[model samples]
Target: MANEAATRLEDVRANIEKACKPSRREPDDVTLIAVSKTHPAEKISPLLEAGHRVFGENRVQEAQQKWPALREAYPGVELHLIGQLQSNKAEDAVALFDCIHALDRVSLVKALGKAMDKAGKRVPCFIQVNIGQEEQKGGCAVSDLPSLIELARSADIPIAGLMCIPPFDIEPAPFFAYLAKLASDNGLEQLSMGMSGDYETAVMLGSTHVRVGTALFGERRKQEQ
Candidate 1:
């Protein structure tokens, strides 16, 4: 498993380098937070051993169970929450993850701020924007971003950037570009959009972070949890 993971990581690194070079960017310019949401903790140790320090999880519950042991074992792995986070779970989320990537609304922002205060740490977060405006998605609509950004900024909960996942049928660049503009217009510095299928396009459009899952771990086995 360790050898397999190393080989896989090399493949990803090569792909990222290729993707970056064509766009006149370095692979390191974009941070790849491997989305390990469904994979078990033991199954991911090889990835950690291979020097893949950053990981992303879609839920707090799974992370709460997995990270405590993983952290004790690895000591330097960084966990990122990359899913729609309920306000009620904000405290636990902030206390556990190094970054939260799905901060979608002002209420969540306010909740995270209050939660951060109690945690004695200013938790970094991204304002998720529904750039595609899909009804089934989790984010503030693009039109509402300004006000949301304002509210988040006023609270000063470490507004690190903007995040989004484009609708499946469309090209991700325009949506990603929209996020870059939102970050620029609002004077924010990071763009945390794109994933396995569209990450190259995202890198070309100046995405600072990409959440990659299948491309890194292959297809996940559905766990009967």
Candidate 2:
């Protein structure tokens, strides 16, 4: 398992390098977040042994179950919450995640603000935008982004950047590009875009962070919740 994980990590790094060439961006500029949402800790351990440090989890509960021991065993592992976060889980999310990529609403901003204040830990957050305007996505509508950013800033939520998942089965470059533009317009520096499938394109288009799961860990063993 370690060997396979190492091989896949090398492949992904090489692809990132290739993607960086055209943009004159160093591969180091892009942080690879292995999305280990549904996978158990045993499966994740091998990658940690292989020296992968950053990981993404889609649920607060599942991550709570698996990460504490792993983090104890291997210090300095960065965890990101890449799923839609409920306002009720704000304190737990603030306590557990080092970064959050799904800050989408004003209510959530207020919740996270209070949570951060109580915990005395300010987690960097990326505002998720409904770039595709897809009804099923969990992101702030494009029209509401400015107001949302202002609210988050006022609440002292430490806005890091913008995040998005383009509608599946379509070319993702345009969506990635649009997201970059939005971040630029808003004076945000970090972009948490791309996934296992289109991370290379995302890198070429100024993605500072890419969340990869299947490509690094192979197929998920169970359905993502």
Candidate 3:
């Protein structure tokens, strides 16, 4: 298992380098966030041994439970919340994760601000955009981004950039392109848009962060609740 995970990690890094070479962007220029949601800490330990430290989780509860043990076992791992966090879990989430990716609404922003105030710690956050206008996703509508960005800027937390998940079956470039435009228009340059399936397109479209799973960890298992 360790050997396989190491091989896959090397392959993914090579792919990133190959994909971004045309743009003059070194693979190191993009941060690869291994999306470990639903995968156990035991399964993740090998990757950590292989020198991969950044891991992304989708749920605050799952992370709170899973990471403490992992942190004790491997103290250097960085946890990033890449899911739509419930405002009610704001305090705990802010305390647990190093960064957050799906902060779209103003209400969540305010809630996290209050939570950070209580904790006296600010977590880095990304503004999520519903670039596809999909009703099922939990991001702010594309039209409302400027206002959200303004709100994020006024808050004490540092706004890292933008994150978006394009519709599953569509070409990821247009969606990535839209995020790139949004970031450019707002004078922000970081774009986090990509996954195991379409990260090459994402790199081609100027993604600063690529959230990858499956390809790195094989298929995801059912997460224990």
Local distance difference test values of all predictions, in order = 0.86, 0.95, 0.89
lDDT computed for candidate 3: 0.89
lDDT per residue for candidate 1 within 1-225, as digits (tens), equals 888888888877777777787668888888888988878877789899998999999999999988898888887888899999999999999899999999888789889988988888887899888888789999998788888878877877888899999999787778887888889998998989878888778887888888988877878766623
In candidate 1 the C-alpha lDDT for residue 204 amounts to: 77
Task: Specify the highest-lDDT model's number.
Answer: 2
> In model 3, which regions exceed 4 Å deviation?
221-225
Give per-residue CA lDDT, model 3, range 1-225, as digits (tens).
Answer: 899999999999999999998889988889999998888877888898888989999999889888898888887888899998989999999899999999989889999999998999988899999989999988999889988888877888688999999998978788898899989998888888899999888998899899999999997545543
The TM-score values for the models, in the order shown, are 0.95, 0.98, 0.96
Candidate that beats the other on lDDT, 1 or 3, i.e. the better one: 3
Clashes of 2: 0
Write the candidate numbers in order of decreasing lDDT.
Answer: 2, 3, 1
Taking all chains together, the TM-score of candidate 1 against the true structure is: 0.95
Give the winner by TM-score.
2
Higher-scoring candidate on lDDT, 1 or 2: 2
Which segments of candidate 2 are over 4 A away from where they belong? 222-225
